[model samples]
Target: MPAIVVERLSKTYFTYKRPPGVWSAVKSLFRRERHEIQAVRDISFTIEEGELVGFLGPNGAGKTTTLKMLSGIIFPTSGAARVLGYVPWERHAEMQRQIALVMGQKMQLWWDLPPYESYLLLKALYEVPDDAFEKRVHELAEMLEIRHVLHTQVRRLSLGERMKCELLAALLHRPRVLFLDEPTIGLDVVSQKRIREFLREYNQRERTTILLTSHYMQDVQELAQRVLIIHHGQLIFDDTLRALVERYSPSKALHLRLEQPADAETLSRFGRIVRMDGLEAVLEVPRELVSRVASEILQSLPVYDITIEEVDIDEIIRDIFAGKREAGALVNTAGS
Candidate 1:
C-alpha cells in the first residue's frame, strides 16, 4: 500500500493587506483589504511504502507547505490526503505514532535540557517500553555517531550535533513514514554527507517511506530514486531523476583533452563550445548526436582523452525554475 496519498491537495492563506503609512494602517482597521495567497495549489502525488522520494522546489514553491499539510501540522484548504492510511489533518493517534516530521529550522528538543532528557520524554509520550527505548536510543545514537554528545545540553551542541539529535528524537519511535524539510540545511559538508548516509541506510533497513525536501541537489541525487518538483504552487514534474534530465535537458557535455591545441572555429564544427583552455575543451552536444559527434571529433581533432557527461542536475533544475525550460509532458498528471 502507498504510504502517502495526496489528491488535489491545496492550501490557501488569507491575510489583510496594509500599505506602509500611519494613515493606511489606521484606515485598514475600519476597512481591510484581504488577499489570498495560494501556497499549495491542487497538487497530487503518492509515495509507496519504502520509497524515498525527493520533494523539490525553490523558496516559496510550496515544498514545506505541502509537507506541513501531510504531517498534520496544518490543514489544507481543499482536497484530501492520507498518510499511512489515515487522513493526516485529523491528527489520529495511530497515524501520528507511525509518522515523523523533522524540519531543520524547528526544534522539538528542549533548549537547556540534554537530548537524553528529551528522548526520555518522547519515550513516555510514545509509550515505548523501558528496555525497547534504551535499545532504540543506543542504536540510533551509535548509528548517528553522537553517543558522546547525547548528554550535552541542546544549546551547547554544535549545529551538526543538534541536527543529528533532532533526527534521533524523530526516529525514537521507529516511524514508518518520515517527512524531512531541509534536514541538511546549514550543515557542514561532512555533516551533510554523514546524515545522507544514515538516512539511506535507515530507509533501506527499516523500509521507511521518506519525503525529503532540500536545496542541495546532492542530497536528492544520492538518496532519492524519484523526485517531485513544484513551482508556483503547482507540481510541475514527477519522475525519476534520469527522466527529469532526459526530458528537460536535451544536451550532453563533452570534456576533451587534446594532444594538440584547437581553435574555437575548429571545435564549433563538432558542437557548441562551452569552454576552452589550451588543449582542453568542453563542448555541449545534442543528446541524440553525442556518440556521432564524439566519433567525429576524435577522428578530426587531436584527441588525447574524451568523456561525455549529462548536464548537471543542478543546472537542469535551475533552468526549469528560471523558465528557460518547460515541464510539458514531464508533468505526471496521474501522480502515481
Candidate 2:
C-alpha cells in the first residue's frame, strides 16, 4: 500500500484587504474586503512506502501549504488526503505518532533549556519506552555528531548545531513518515553533507517514506531521484530527476580550449557563445547537433581540448520555475 495518498488536495487562505489611504482604511472597518488566495489548487499524487520524493517550487507556489496539510498542521480547503491510511486533518493520535514534520524556520526545542530536557519531554509525550528512547538517542546523536552539545542550551548553539538537535528530537520516536521543509537551510557545506549522509542511511536502513521541500537543488539532487514541481498552485511536473533534465533541457554546453586565440565572431558560426576568455570558450549547442558542431570546430578551428557537458540541473530547474519552459507531453515517470 502507498504510504501517502492525496487526491485533488487544496488549501485556500482568506485575508482582509485594505487600501493605502487613511480614509480607505477607516471605511474598511465597517465594510471589509476579503481576498481569496489559492495556496494549493487541485494537487494530487501518491507516495509508495520507502520512496524519497522531492517537492519543488518557487516561493508562494504552495509547496509548504501542501506539506502543512499532509502533516495535519492545517486543514485543506477541499479534496481528500490519506497519510498512512488516515485522514491527516482529523488529528488522530495513532496517525500523529507515525509521522514527523521538521521545518527549518520553526522550532520545537525550548530556547532556554538544554536539548536533553526537550528530548525527555518528547519521549514522555510520544510514550516511547525508556530503553528504546535511550538507544535511539544514542544512535541519532552519534550519527549527527552532536553528542557533545546535547546538554547545551538551544539558544546558545550554532545554527548547524541547533538544526541537528531539532532533527534528533523529531526522529526520536522513529516515525515511519517524514515531512522535511528546508532542513538544510542556513547550514554550511560540511553540515549539509553530513545531514544528507545521515538522511540517506536512515532512509535505506529504516525504509522511511520522505517528502522533502527545499530551495537547495543539491539537496534534491543528492537525496531524491524523483522530484515533483509545483507552480501557480498546481503540479507542473512529476518525474525522475534525470528525465526532468532530458525532457526540459534543449541544449548541451561545450567547453573548448584552443591552440590559438579565437575571436567571438569566429566562434559564432558554430553555436551561441556563452562565455570566452583568452583561448578558452564555452558554447551552447543544440543537443542533437553537439557532435556535429564539435567535429566541425575541431576540423575548422585550432582546438587543444574540448569537453561536452549536459546542462546544469540548477539551470534547467530555474527555467522551469521561471515559466521559460513547460514540461512537455511526456508521460509521468515518477512512480517508476
Cα lDDT tens digits, model 1, 3-25, are 99999999999998898999998
- Lowest summed lDDT over 10 consecutive residues: which window, candidate 2? 327-336
lDDT of 2 at 147: 98
State the local distance difference test value for candidate 2. 0.91
Q: Determine which window of 10 residues in candidate 1 has minimal summed lDDT.
A: 327-336
Model 1 stretches with alpha carbons more than 4 Å out: 19-30, 262-269
Per-residue lDDT tens digits for candidate 2, residues 165-238, read 99999999988999999899988999989888989988998999999998999999999988999887888888
Displacement of residue 48 (Cα, Å) in model 1 is 0.6
Error of 1 at 55 (Å): 1.0
Model 2 Cα shift for residue 224 (angstroms): 1.2
